[model samples]
Target: MNKPSSCVRRALSLRPCAFAVLSLAAACAAHAEQPMQPLLLAQNARMPSLQDMVVTATRTEQPLSDLVADISIVDRETIEHSGATGVADLLARLPGVEITRNGGIGNATSMYLRGAETRFTAVYIDGVRVDSQSTGGAQWEQIPLAQIERIEVLRGPAAAVYGSDAIGGVIQLFTRKGEGAAAPYVGVGLGSQGTRKLEAGISGAIGADKALDYSLGLAHARSDGFDTKTSGAHNPDRDGYRSTSGNARLGYQINARHKLDATLLASRMNSGYDAFTYKPASPVDDRNLHRLHTAGLTWAAQWTEAYSTRVSVTDSASCYETTPSLYRTETSLRGYVWQNEYRLGAHRFSAALERREDRLDNPALTASGLAINQGRSQDALALGYGYSAGGHTVQVNLRHDDDSEFGGKGTGSVAYGYAIAPAWRVTASLGTAFRAPTLYQRFSEYGLPTLRPESGRNAELGLRYAEGRSTFSAVVYRNRVSNLIVFSAPGGCPSTFGCYASTARAQYEGLTLAASQQWAGVQWHGSIDIQNPRDLDTGKQLRRRAKHHATFGADTQVAGWTLGAEVQASGRRFENETNTQVLGGYTLVNLYASTRLARDYTLLARIDNLGDKAYELARTYATPGRTFYVGLKWAPQ
Candidate 1:
């Protein structure tokens, strides 16, 4: 049980010299060809052109521009104009993603990528696997965003093609099958401390080319206590919480290469704050109860013109209860996934296999009540090859993963692109990743079981520029991690072990910039991200990382009315993990308006934290000062 460390045996001895230097630099870059501009044909003509099909990359179904990893797609008008209320606030407004919240808004949420480790990302809805697996994270308030329609973010390290927590990257949530017209929509909101919210949805379609589509939605929200106690006393009205979620999907297309799909999802939540008490006089309310359910089945096969296959099966269950009882927990999981693809023209290949069986019921463990009932199986294999002559585009990937609970790992990546004319372009990537060891870090009987499995290496560079109606992008990244598993201080244990494993090594670097524009009809968007995330083996400074995050927004219409403004920023951070609790930087400004009183009604208003900054993202969790909200939305056709 203690033989998987030394950084996973030097990343499994550099995986056969990194797959022979990425197969000899992808066969000497296979004749490069990079000319394709006009802003990549206007970003592929602002997509939604809808004709070319075949997706689900890796597990078969190709042609989404013939994949080379690093994917992003968010539609439904960017999820209804991104006034997000879930899906982790729409993946915290994308662009290298990062979100961590423990205060305000539905509590516990975590997601991090590029700078990895929030159990190394990997969340899926329509493809099953919705985190957890005994605390590898992702409850995100049980996920509801009124049956999301699309979201895909693939970034990097897909555990050789999606298996074992994907080692940092992969988020897919596609729901909302089809149903063009049996509609009903509703909304309600009120903000600030005593905030309130309500939502409703309905959709229908059951046969014909509609091939079955269904949707149902409901939402509820509440808030109150803004915290203050130790003696400064003010606690009791601690925000209340409630939630309900539901989803269903069905698709069948027995022809053109067979297809079948089925899905069901459910959620329930109840909340009240304050847990984690190591006897500060032991009085913590924070009642909590959460439940989740999932069911899935999928099959896609296209065994000709280049072979393809995909199979899926999923069952998920989660339960968490807290009302003292030492914070009870329950989990059940079942998964089986299979994927295969084979193409031999310009060459492409993929393979994946996953099996998960988990059962854990806890009674504050010490091994009572089925402390852990583990079952893990993952076997992944991936191969990617791409080539385009003259102008330049090169890709090479290789992956391997074998785990029955941490055993065997391999990863490799390389990417390159060039098209330095017709509006510019550039891209570069290098990768390696690994993460495993979480069943509460290897069968927690109160932690420390010689845990290990956190590894990394990454590098990136990007740039894109366009013309006419403005567009721009910039990205830079660096990540380095090693054996990172922390939580020591019980005298750094090991007198025959009680706990001790904090010799952290971390380094995260970031820079992301974005720009957008549209003239006369007015629309402008902005983005900025800068991160440092330290701790190169004790130089300290990496807790709740945030060193400048920014966002700006604008929208305009002005005749039939539609105006907006948004500003978000976060800079100061450090809420413990021995950084001694800082948390300063803050900026939040929001304002929105919509009007169109007739054609089926619409009128909305929002003001939100317009400068009432008395922050605390977690030093006893404060957050939530200024607030306001007004709303009305209805669709009547």
Candidate 2:
């Protein structure tokens, strides 16, 4: 009899998982068997900063619970406990956020916020906007999770504050920073799908006065994934991927009123896959190379106790190369902004001016070996005001954008909130937003130069309650989108090449509810989302969007160990607007545990897809099956 296959051997290798579980349980029992001193000691110690400040909701730092907009915050503690390696995993858990991908990791990804298209959603890192000019989507896979300290999401129109690409709302990422002293850490792990990963980082304050600070992170991962296509006629070879990313930041506090900072982030990826082509095409290997980089600089000063100003600059680029086919593309963006704010009595006012340019290089293989490039630029101005007095707050903003190719457009928003009681509040908001046509959508082959900007309106009413260790929030919104771009071969256009047109409309209405509580020694959090997205032309549901979804998770510490479980479920989605192809709904359950090994070291393990259930996040794509990962981490004290 031959030896068991490699996959079989790995499956049987879960003996370590069993061992870890037993060890964790034994350690917990031993601690539980003792007095509850540790728990009491932890509770007595001043809690880790419960008052979290966020700026994404309104471009100003304010208490998370006090913001009038619908917002979600993914703190560092939550990110660490979720046992997620990919940013997509973390995003899928948020309320009203949806994702779709071509395959597994390293593949093209898409995100929909409040049922809006990916391009309409804006992404920012350290106040710098980043996106591919051609596709208008952020390179989510290239962002290393280990380098991020937190993420904030706003789920409504934000064009009045940030200009274009804010029709769906905004997401901001903050990088890690050095604390009091130097701290360094490292980690390594292995799991299913032949996956391997390594990460290391260090952060510290420098100089006698500790006025200078620096932080850096490095990460690399590789995985041999299963066939991308689960059904239909396609290649069966295993697809594999490799990725490396790095992020670094430097800061200097010149004085009590002046400060300067710089940040850089870069990433590279190589992926292999099988292509399904009927006509004559390259029979050789199919692969792609992807690279993304961003850099930013800022100088801020406080002229007086109530007046301040800032100036910033940012640059970002995204590049892609395809093998065999010899296709390559590069998109770059440069931005500059000047902002000022003044505080008077019980009101604050702000003004900003911004200029941004986009460039793309996609040369055609002409007879003469020549290349052609395309570019566009835009200028925008914004004004905002806020007032807070006696448990009541109100905010409003207005902006105007002028593009070189599309002329000019204006947008505005207003929000009001009142506290019913010390622990309860009610809020209402109305906003307008727009998405400009991408270069590919307006000037490429079969593109329409006469296309107009897609515009929309958002109206929301919300209720929130917070008391002791329990908190809950609910929001209901209605959105109307007009001048949607679509492709059709009208009259003079040839059937081989359809032309783009803008006359369509859409409506999206949704409700989101979320809650969290901590009692005794256990903590739990959950969210539910119900939405209806429809195309006004055909009165049909949007393709690849579920009408309902929910998530629940809980964790507790027993003795010297902590254990947790999570569940995520989504309703069925149609592959086409006509609703012929039905992609079934799915539910996934996961388990994770952690325990301290020594003074400065710890052990972590997780079992994903605990029951080995099969599911689909996208049509014809194969999602991960039963898998697990075990790792050890160490940090300097």
What's the residue-level lDDT of 329 in candidate 2? 65
lDDT of all predictions: 0.62, 0.74
Q: Which ranges in model 2 have alpha carbons more than 4 Å from their true place?
A: 1-50, 278-284, 365-372, 490-495
Scanning candidate 1 in windows of ten residues, the lowest lDDT window is 6-15
Q: Write the per-residue lDDT of candidate 2 for residues 1-637, one digit (tens) a residue.
A: 1111111111000011334223322322222222211110011111112256778876767665445787777766566655576676778788788888777777777888888888888888878787776676686765667667778888999999988889888989888777569889897888888888888999889886788998998988888877777766556667677878888888898998898889888777777655554123324456657777778898888999989888899888777666645656677888899888898987889899999898877665534333337788889999999887788888899999999888898999999999898656799999999988777666656566688999999999997755555556678998899998777675332225577777889888888766655546675656667888889889888888888776667778887888878777788888887888887877778888888889898788889889898877778888778889887778866
Kindly provide the TM-score of model 1 when superposed on the true structure, using C-alpha atoms: 0.30
Name the lDDT value of residue 176 in candidate 1.
71
Best by lDDT: 2
Global CA lDDT computed for model 1: 0.62
Residue pairs that clash (backbone atoms under 3 angstroms), model 2:
none
TM-score of each: 0.30, 0.89
Which candidate has the top score in TM-score? 2
What would the per-residue lDDT of candidate 1 be over residues 222-339, giving only the tens digit for each residue?
5563553222333355656666666766667777788887888776666666554524554555556677777788888888988787788887776666654445565666678777
